[model samples]
Every structure is written in C-alpha cells, then in structure tokens.
Target: MTELVRLTGVSKRYETTGPPALDEVSVEVGTGAAVAVMGPSGSGKSTLLNLVGGLDRPTSGTVEVAGEDLGRLSEKRLAVFRRTHVGIVFQFFHLLDDLTVRDNVLLPAQLAGVPPRTARARATELMDALGLGEKANAYPARLSGGQRQRVAIARALVNRPALLLADEPTGAVDARTGAQVTEILRELNRDGQTLLLVTHDRAMADRCAGRVVELSDGRVVASTPAGVSS
Candidate 1:
C-alpha cells in the first residue's frame, strides 16, 4: 500500500533543558489503513497527532502527510493543506455551539472554497449517512454527546480529506456513546478512509484500527496488527 503518513526520527521539545516530548520516533501509516496510537498520558500521543496534522512542527526530523512534507510548508500553506487534505476530530467535540449542525459541517467546505450548493449537498449527504439528518437544524448544545461527536465527524469529513486524524475520539462520552462512536469510525475505515487515531481505549483501537502503535516514555515500544496483544 502507498504510505499516507511518514514520520522519521521525529522529536519535539518545548524547552532545551527538559526531556523531549517525542524521542526519535518513526512511524508510517499506509493508505486506506486505520492506525491507532496508544499510550499513557504524557507518552507523546498528542504531540504525534499535532505533528501529522501540521498543528505543530517537530523540533527535529520530518513529518510528511499525503506526500506533503509538513515541516516545509509555510503557515499559510499549511492551513491550506489542512483544509484541503486533512481533517481532524477532537475529543471534546469542538462544535460551535452557536451554529446549527449543518453550518458547522459546512464551515470547512466554505473555507476551502467549495461552492455553497455543493457544500450543502455534501453536508446533507454526510449527515444522512451518519444518522444525523434530523439533528442538522439543531444547535450542538441540544444534542446528546454521541450526536455531537457524530456532528464533529461529519464536519471533519465534509472536505473529503486524504487523511483523518482523531484524537481520543471517545474520551469525553459515556460508555454507550463511545461504543456508537467506535462503530462509526469502524464503518468509515471499512469504506476506505485512512485514519490515524490517538486513544487510550483498547476496545476502540481493536474495533477501529487494522494496526496499532504503542508508545511509552516518548518512544515507540511496540507495533502490531490490531486484535493482537501488544
């Protein structure tokens, strides 16, 4: 399979004196693969996601996503790259409470210059697929946790990004809600959306990922096919 994401000897350090947040980590995610990054808190999972998403640059080494070297892009270009090629779903369900679900999902497409009619059509299709059609006219605060996360997922996918990066997607929801989210992610991967997810939830990893990378103390300790013990 083609490589969709590649990180070579990447490290991030906030200060010169402290230990690096990432310690010479190397990881590659192939096209159409669902990969889970699992680690304890402070194990550098978020840093890895940020680097891949172009939200932060490595202090050393390179991060390449969808064939573009993130470290080489200027901030403006990176923003464009993110809107055009990458989509991110956060643990907190970062929906704009003031906007209706349709608007939230339409925002990325609008920012990317998708024609309003086309963006609305795409948003409607995604919402229907995610079983969120009825909630499209509702505010985020009016939806359940699971519904809100589904809205976030719909928003992330509105741009048809080459890569989807989900950070602890189930962390803030109840167990039942998390299960629903897990199934949604699994279905998305089955439909060939490349996914790189950071999570502490083992069940989610096993359910949604074809492969898993384990991190410890800022370094990769193991990598295995999903459903195998790491």
Candidate 2:
C-alpha cells in the first residue's frame, strides 16, 4: 500500500512545559489501513492526530501527509492542503449548532470551491450512508450524541479525502452507540478509506486493523496486533 502519512522526529512543546507533548515520534500509516493510537490523558494522542490532519504544526521535525511536508506550507496553502487531502473527526462532534445537518456537511466542499450542486449531491450521499437522510434539515442540537458524531463524520468525508483522522470519535456516546459508530468507520475503511484513530477504549482499538501503537509521557511504550504488550 502507498504511504498516506509519515512523521519524522516529530516533537511538540507548549510554553515552558514539563516535557514536550510529542517526543521525537516517528510513525506512518499506509493507504487503506486503520491504525489505532492509544495513550493516557495528555499523552499527546490528540496532538499527534492534529499534526497528521494539519490542524497543528510540530515544533521540530516533519509531518508529511500524502507526501506533502506540512511544515513547509504557509497558512493559506496548508488550509488548501487540508481541504484537499485530510478529513478530521474530533472527540467532540464539533457540529455547527446553527446549521442544518446538510449545511454542516456541505461546508467543507463549499470551502473547497466545489460546485453547489455537486457538493449537495455528495452531502446527500454521505447522509444516506450514515443513515442521516431523514435528519438533513435538523440542527445538530436536536440530534443525539451518536447522531451528531455521524453528522460530523459526514462533514469530514464530504470532500472524499485520502486520509481520515479521528480523535476518540466514540468518546461521548454510550457503548452500544459507540460500537455502532465503530462499525460505520470499519465499513468505510473496508471501502478503502485510510484511517488513523486516537482512542482510549482498548476494545474499540482492537477491532480496527491489527496494528496498535501505545503512548505514555510523550513517547511510545508499546505496539502490537492485540492490546497486550509485546
């Protein structure tokens, strides 16, 4: 498979911090693979996800997504890069409270300058895929946690990005609903969407592609096909 993302000696630090959030971390995810990233709170799991999705930049080293080095791009170029290549799903649904579900999903494609008719068609397809076809006109506040997250996923995917970055997507929902969301992600992956997910739920991580990377105190501690330490 082709490499979709790569990090080389990546490290990030906040102002006068105890230690960097990410410490010389290097990893890669190939096309169509699902990589599970597990770590304790403040272990830089979200930071890693952010960098991969071009939401944040590294303090040192490099972040390459779809072969483009993000550190080299200006803010405007990075915005275009993000829209063209990456799709991000957050732990929080991050839906627009004021927008209808269809409008929310259409935002990315709109920002990317997709034709209105084409963007609407794609948004409709995504809503249908996520079983949200009936709720297209509803505001996010009217939806349940799972439904909101599904809407967020649809928004992320509206542009058909090459990579999907999810940050604990199941964090706010009940176990059953979380499982349902996981299945939706799995189905997408099977349909050839490359996925990288940051998750605290070990069981959920295990259900993804057999590779897992565990982090602690800003460094990787273990990685395995199963949850057990190797």
Candidate 3:
C-alpha cells in the first residue's frame, strides 16, 4: 500500500528545560490503514497526533503526510494543506451551536472552495449515511451526544481528506454511544479511508484499527496487530 504518513526520528520539546514531549519517535502509516496510538496521560499521544495533523511542528526530525513535508511548510501553506488534505475529529463534538447539522457538515467543504451545490450534496449524503438525515435542520444543542459526534464525523469527512485523525473520539460519550461511534469508524476504514486515532479505550482501538502503537513517556513501547493487547 502507499504510505500516507511518515515520521522520522521526531522529537518535540517545549522548552530547553525538562524532557521532550516526543523522543525519537518514528512511525509510518499506510494508505487505507487504520492505526491507533494509545497511552496514558502525558505519554505524548496527543503530541504525536498534533504533529501528524499539522497542528504543531516537532523540534527535530520530519513529519510527512500525503507526500508533503509538514515541517517545511509556512504557516499559511500548512493551514491550506491541512484544509485540503487532512480531516480531524476531536473528543468533544466541536460543532457550532448556531449552525444546523447540514450547515456544520458543509462548513469544511465550503472553506475548501468546493462548489456550494456539491458541498450541499456531500453533506446531505453523509448526514443520511450517518443516520442524521432527519436532524439536518437541527442545531447541535438539540442533538444527543451520539448524534453530535456523528455530525462531527460528517464534518470531518465532507472534504474527502487524504488522512483522518481522530483524538479520543469516544471519550465524551456513554458506552453504547461510544460503540456506535466505533462502528462508524470501522465502516469508514473498511471503505478505504486512512485513519489514525489517538485514544485511551482499548476496545475502540481493537474494534476500529488494524494495528495499535502503544506509547509511554513519549516513546513507543509496542507496535502490534490490533486485538493483540499491548
């Protein structure tokens, strides 16, 4: 498979003092693969995710996603690249409370310069597929946690990004809702979406990812096939 993400000897240090947030971390994720990065708090899981998503730059080494070197891009270029090539879903549903579900889903595509008609169609299709078709005119505050998250997922995917990065996607939901989200992610991956998820839930990782990379103290401790407990 083609490579979608690559990190070589990556390290991130906030200040001259203290240990690096990431230490010599190297990881590769191939196209259409779903990989989970899991660890306890302060293990650099978020740091790794941010670097891969182009939200932050590493102090040393390189980060390449979809054949573009993120570390080399200017802030404006990087922002454009992220808008065009990456999709991100956060633990909290970051939907705009004032916007309707359809509007929220169409926001990314609109910002990316997709035609209004095409964006609307894509948003409609995604909302329908995610079982949110009836909720299209509703605002986020009126939706259940699961429904909100589904909206977030739809918004993330409307632009058809090359890589999807989810950070603790199920962290804010109940067990049943979390499972529902996991299934959605699994189905998306099965349909050939490249996914990299950073999560603490082993069940979520096992259910949605093909491989799991475990981290501790900013270092990779294990890399194994999913369901093989780290």
Write candidate 2's Cα lDDT for 1-230 as tens digits.
Answer: 88888899999997666789999998888888898999889999999999998888999999999889999999999999999898999889889899999999999999999999999999999999899999999999999999999999999999999999899999999999999989988888889999999988888887765579888977888767755644
Better of 1 and 2 by lDDT: 1
Tens-digit lDDT string for candidate 1 (102-210)? 9999999999999999999999999999999999899998999999999999999999998999999999999999999999999999999999999999999999999
The lDDT per prediction is 0.95, 0.91, 0.95
Q: What is the lDDT of residue 1 in candidate 1?
A: 99
- Cα error, candidate 1, residue 115 (Å): 0.3
How should the candidates be ordered by TM-score, best one leading?
1, 3, 2
Question: Can you tell me which runs of candidate 1 are displaced by over 4 Å?
Answer: none
Comparing candidate 2 with candidate 3, which one achieves the higher TM-score? 3
By the TM-score metric, which is better: model 1 or model 2? 1
TM-score of each: 0.99, 0.97, 0.98
Clash number by candidate, in order: 0, 0, 0
